[model samples]
Structures are given as structure tokens and as C-alpha cells.
Target: MPYATSAAFAHDWPDTVRLVTVEGAPHTGAWNADAYAYAYAYAKELAAFLAQHT
Candidate 1:
């Protein structure tokens, strides 16, 4: 989905939604692209989100 759409969805549920944007990452790059520079940061953000929510 487009970033704007995602951002809007998150905005609709501000209390329970979190948005993480990787500036140069592709559609799935943040999670699946090993060579992408921000892959580790994506994982770290996901971990942090899980830790906070769980």
C-alpha cells in the first residue's frame, strides 16, 4: 500500500498504531531485503514495537 494510505490508517487509530518509514526502502525491503541498509533498523523497530506491546 502507498505510504500515505498506510499513514492515514495509522492516524485513524493513533492510540494503537505505529508507523515506521524507511526512507529508501522498497515495498518489502524493510523486512526482506538483506542488503538494504535499513534492514537491521527495521528489525530493531519491530522488536521494540513487540516488546512494548506484548
Candidate 2:
């Protein structure tokens, strides 16, 4: 599958949230990206914190 251009996204998400999925995304690639580290860590910390808090 191919990703649509910005124009397509603009049209699709104009009135609603248009979510895109990466087909065949490499497993754990996001975890390896430096930019994604914080997000992944935050998600883990939030999950654990919620479990303990609740």
C-alpha cells in the first residue's frame, strides 16, 4: 500500500481524525527510533503507574 500525499490527508481529515496505518511496518522499528523512545517509555511508565495507582 502507498501513503497518500498531504492533500489527501487534508481532505480526509478535514472534519474528522484520519488515522493512517503503515502497512508491513517493521516490528519494533518505532521502539528503535530515538524520537520514539520517549513516547514508548512514557506509554510504559503510564501503564505501570496506572496499574499501581488504581
Candidate 3:
């Protein structure tokens, strides 16, 4: 989704939502081999989020 839309959605739950945006990243960019950094960051973020929530 677009950044604006994502921000808006996060706005609805300001206290609980954590929005992480990767510049110039496509929807599936994190899965691409060319996007290793983004993928690593995504995985790290996801792990942190899950750890916090669980």
C-alpha cells in the first residue's frame, strides 16, 4: 500500500501501530534477492514486533 494509506491506517491505532517504511521499495521488494538489506531489515523488524506482541 501507499505510504499515505499506510500512515492513515496506522493513525487509527496510534498507540498500537508501528509503521516501518522502506524507501523506493516495491510491494514484494523484501523478497527479492536484490533487496537483501530490505529483507533483513524486514525480518528483524518482524521478529521484534512479534517478540513484543507475544
lDDT of 2 by residue, 17-52 (tens): 333233344434434445465476657767876786
For residue 29, model 3's alpha carbon misses the true position, in angstroms, by 4.7
lDDT of 1 by residue, 1-54 (tens): 887888898899988888876666676565554455576776787999999989
Give lDDT tens digits, candidate 3, residues 1-54.
676787898899887887766667665554563467777877898999999989
Q: For model 2, which pairs clash?
A: none
Error of 3 at 15 (Å): 2.2
Instruction: Per model, state how many residue pairs clash.
Output: 0, 0, 0
Ranking by lDDT: 1, 3, 2
Cα lDDT for residue 3, candidate 2 = 44
Model 3 spans > 4 angstroms off: 26-34
Ranking by TM-score: 3, 1, 2
Give the C-alpha lDDT of model 3. Answer: 0.75
Quote each prediction's TM-score. 0.59, 0.36, 0.62
